[model samples]
Target: MTPPPGWYPDPQAPHLERWWDGAVWTEHLRAPEVPGPPQPAGGVSGRAKAVALTSAAVVLVAAIVTGVAVLGEDDDGGGPATGALPTSVPSTDLPTPTPTRTTSEPPADPDAVPDVVVDELNGITLPLPDGWTPPKNVPEDDVVMTTDDGTYECPAGVGLCRHGLVLTRTVTENDEKSPETLAEQDIPDAADAAYDRDTLDRRLYGGIESHRTVKSGPVAVAGRAGYFVRWRVKTADGPGGYVQSLAFPSSVGSESPVIVRFVFDAGPDGPPLADMDRITKGIRSIGDADTGGGVGSSIGPTG
Candidate 1:
């Protein structure tokens, strides 16, 4: 009798099993299943052993057929075997990954103010007049424009000095917010810093001898209401100079008050007093494009 379709030990390859299509061996093959413990061969003839082995093989094949039928019933009928895993199935429940982004500030335009000194902290720009340029060796945050005549021996015999100096800085330590009040309060210190004495208490401008208010009034600066206090200072040894403190609210940031201090030697060599008015008129916000005369323009004493 012919055997039913099932996996059986391959006649050509004893280590593996081949498929029998109920009549002949098919090409499919698989590893043989693990064998049971050895049966006792004592007192058994070779023929009898063969008969027993044939019967056991038939039983095993029938059991394998039953297992396959059960698996087919559990799976989608005539589809893949039960419990088989797919190669690559995408999941709908998981979130897709997103890429990260970065940002930065834009670069400043070089052509915006080609001939000015920009003070970024105070959000203002000071125009460099024909005979003036930015001073070297000054603090990074302190903005100063001075006469191109450069540094010279101080008449007071203390340190190097510039004949004309215009310095700008933000007022952070003071509690006063009024532009007029702050301007008035800053003039004395501005004079002292420029003419009276150095940080080492050494005399400057031969030590300021006497100072009288030359200009004091409400004014407009950089399109904002402001005030300035200018003084004609007398020094002990060299030509005396003028010192002025101008205060205004910043156009950018937290709108903090800003102070600009001006110092000019009192002689034929010092920067012209008219330059003071020119610089004052030229004061503007960092990015302002207006070239017209500044608001509330005022010219200082020429002599």
Candidate 2:
């Protein structure tokens, strides 16, 4: 018959004890308790008394041995060490170690955001979203950037289907007129013409219906002072929408400022104005250039 589950002296080892985990002898083992010093034998008359004291001593030692074995029990629920431990030696107390915090930084997410487009012209730079791309050729004075793969559009085959977002920059010499005055005068004219490129290429044609100013105020772009104007335009070909334009003087005192316009015709779902503002703020002037602000140019009323 198999022995019951318990700690027992190992038959294979001379002095070490092993745990018989009910079915098998486990690897857990401990050295047997060290034998104590021999006691001196008493005289013949005192022999009887000596024997009685010896019996009591054995009982006391047995109790101590059992306690030492139980104390060796593993906290992990594993079997206790098999051998008897010396009762005379004290157990060492150890401090529990605290866990450490990791300081390594996490890697950047590759697919978290879309790519960006940077447009540089006339020494000024503008950062646009990924969809915006440069056309093969636009008007010499104006740098036009458009989004070709945009999901937003008007019905196909219509008279004025929106071709995604359109950003146009018109660099003109300072004509002494304030930015607000120039925008107020130019926007109405462009809207009155219906933004017809063939009829008025340089001036924006707002269509037959007309374009009205929605809001206008002072603003700053890339740390340069500027004026911002919002417009509402309607056309016969498609639903009417809003246009945002920002014009700022490139240099102080008699220097012409650049006019940047953002036009998108969305019927109900309009462009996110906050995001547009962020894009506008990204505008930076790399350096000054001779933009050749000539008379009757697109920058002023003459064009």
Candidate 3:
């Protein structure tokens, strides 16, 4: 006959007790309880009570151990059991951050000089002499300073013209050429652009009849050694004019060659010739610092 539902010795694990549910053995298990003293006068003895309490304590501890094993199997597929503390996943490798670079030089000052025109685009500054002012209609990339007298009817009877003009720009197209070669090649074009013809193919100065070199040599401008070619052109009408092409490496960016063109009516009405030298001397970096070698000191010809 099968035993009733109660603790009994396990056949598989002899050291532990298994439950018999009348029909078959169940998974519930515990330790076997030890016997106590016999009862006296139909009342429970103190030793019997003590044995019952000890057995109950042992059952409670066994139940807790079995429950913890079940929880560990459910959570981690038979891994070690853990307490109530939360667990964190392992972190992945992260990329290091890049460091930023900083400069020690102070910022440029705009009001470092009086009566100056700052060409922030070209990274240079020019002295605004008494009679010259920045032109409004010119493109922002090009720097132009014209006489205060402004435009007048061209001597060639087409469009308007200025008696005195100075323009500066970077030589982007053929900047690979040397400053001297660039200056020499640019003077003839400068003459045509200033005195010979306007953009519309109209003879602004009645067209250039002839041109002769007035000065051609090495010169210092804004502390950089450079070259200049000045030409006295005779036009078909009007009192002709002088055109000059000055080329030097910029002190600020890429050291690219910069060209400054000067066109002035040849006589009392135009700006004085000495103003050219004065303007060259006054040229400086935007911050009023001399980064180039020497300012306006003419070194003899390279030839």
Per-residue lDDT over 186-287 for candidate 2, one digit per residue giving the tens place of the 0 to 100 score: 565434433434333432323436666667776665455666777777765556556666766654333466667666654555454454565565655554
Cα RMSDs of all predictions? Answer: 21.2, 15.3, 23.0
Task: Give the lowest summed-lDDT range of ten residues in model 2.
Answer: 294-303
Q: What is candidate 2's CA lDDT for residue 113? A: 38
- Best-matching candidate per lDDT: 1
Model 3 per-residue lDDT at 127:
81
Model 3, position 32, has a per-residue lDDT of 60
- Clashing residue pairs in all predictions, respectively, total 0, 7, 1
Residue 241 error for model 3, in Å?
Answer: 0.4
lDDT of 3 at 163: 78
Each candidate's TM vs. the true structure? Answer: 0.58, 0.46, 0.58
Off by over 4 Å in 3: 1-114, 138-143, 175-177, 289-303
The pairs that clash in candidate 1 are none
